[model samples]
Target: MIRVALVGNAGIGSQDHQNSMYRPAFERHPRFELVDTAEEAEVLSIAVPLAERGTAVADAIRAGKHVLADKPLAATLAEATEIERLAAAHGVVVVPAHHQRFGAALRSAIAAVRAGRVGLPWNVQCDFVVAGGDPAPTGELVNFGLYPVDVLRALLGLEVHRVHATGTPDLVTLLLDHEHGVTSTVVCGRVPALRDVPPGGLAVHRYRISGSHGVLAVDARKPALQVRTTDTFGPVWTGPGTVDVLLDVLAAGIAAGRAALGPHDAVQAQRVIEAAQRSMAVGQPVAIGQPVETGE
Candidate 1:
């Protein structure tokens, strides 16, 4: 059995709630055991806020444990890269828990894209809003950027070249230009929860992908997902977005000595978010140069 330790939950402001959404997953899995501390575990599953995740991850890696950290590894790309380097030097597999990427259904879609069913996806559009009517729109970028960025980047498998964004907090749209002439247009927002819907119901999520031969689309209302509302304590994860899948992936990574998903893609997602924020601020397109390390 793989012994695991979980750190952080929902957000930075919230105290460490040991009854995390991840708890049930680890304890229920036959191959896993939930350890009380990082010292007793072979793997650390970290879901701390973006600012502090870097330190938590680095500490775990230094202790020679594999880690599955949450998205937006650190404040800046440089710090995120350094953490990746630290993990490499320690010879431990460190991956980001881009949870949605590992869902069985989405996995099939990814497989189809890889198999050339779509003949190189060149155009993509996504619209996702999971909240009530009123929310402070200013915080939407931080609240909404990571998941779609990760998903779009996975679909394209290329670095973004430029980003242009427009709209107020209630709605924000972004045009992302990727390498090799591929592009994506995205609209995202998250407000407080709608009391009308139950726990499993999310607002709206739609995706349209166009390739040379065909197009793939997914449109759903109230799909089974776990989302946090402004009023809720935190996101209570279940279904495909649960922490169970992340731990399963981590266990397999440890056995293979390599992670199926690495931190690089998540770092790329952060770069896209950074560029989009700049785009929104300047009222014009922002260039996202390829990531390079300056060994300073």
Candidate 2:
């Protein structure tokens, strides 16, 4: 069994609730034993906000423990890179919990693209937005935007070359140029909850990929289940048994002594987001793919 230490479930601020969500998963997993402090566990599951995540992961690494961090890893690309370097120096595994990649629609899309069913993907369009929950738009972007960016990279094997973005954090659009001649356009941000939905229809997440031979599309928010109540109704956003899936991946990665979603991937995703934020701020495109200097 892997002894697990869960870090930062203070549940006080923005993403602190994320840390608490994993408790049930850990409690139920047969292969995991939840410990109170980082010192007692061989692995650490860090679900703190982006700003606090780097410190948490670094602490875990210094304690000679592997880490599974929540998405985005760090608020800035430079910090993500620093975390990667630290993990490397310590010879510990550190990974992001990009649960969206394990979703059925994206998984099928990847399989089709790799099987040449979509022929060589040249252009992709993605929209992932949700109702804002009392945070700055940029923070929400950093929190959620990393999912699609990671998915695009995994599917196309492309690295971001440039990013152009506009609008506030509540609503923004991005044009991303990648290697391998692939391009992606993303429009994502939080907005006020829309009215007139039957409860489950408010989701804004969608994607379309065009290749030489075919096109792949996914409505990530497409409701799979709906519940009716006296006063409200809504769809369940999570996939069936996805918690189990994530648990399985975590257990396997721990057992194998590796990270399924490593720090390099986190940095790559953060680079696109940081570039986009910069692009919007300066009203110009930001170039990417250059090596960053993370001074020790």
Candidate of highest TM-score? 2
Model 1, 198-295: lDDT tens digits are 43234666678899999987653323455666765333434454356766777778898887777776678778888888888899999987675834
Maximum-lDDT candidate: 2
Tens-digit lDDT track of model 2 for 120-233 = 899999987776355553455675778888888877878999999987776788899998778899887776755534321235777898999989888765536676688666
Which stretches of model 1 miss by more than 4 angstroms? 10-19, 133-138, 195-201, 220-242, 292-296
User: How many pairs of residues in model 1 come into backbone collision?
Assistant: 0
User: What TM-score quantifies how close candidate 2 is to the native fold?
Assistant: 0.88
Instruction: Score residue 262 of candidate 2 by CA lDDT.
Output: 80
What's the alpha carbon RMSD for model 1?
4.9
Could you estimate the TM-score for every candidate?
0.84, 0.88
In order of listing, the candidates' clash counts read 0, 0
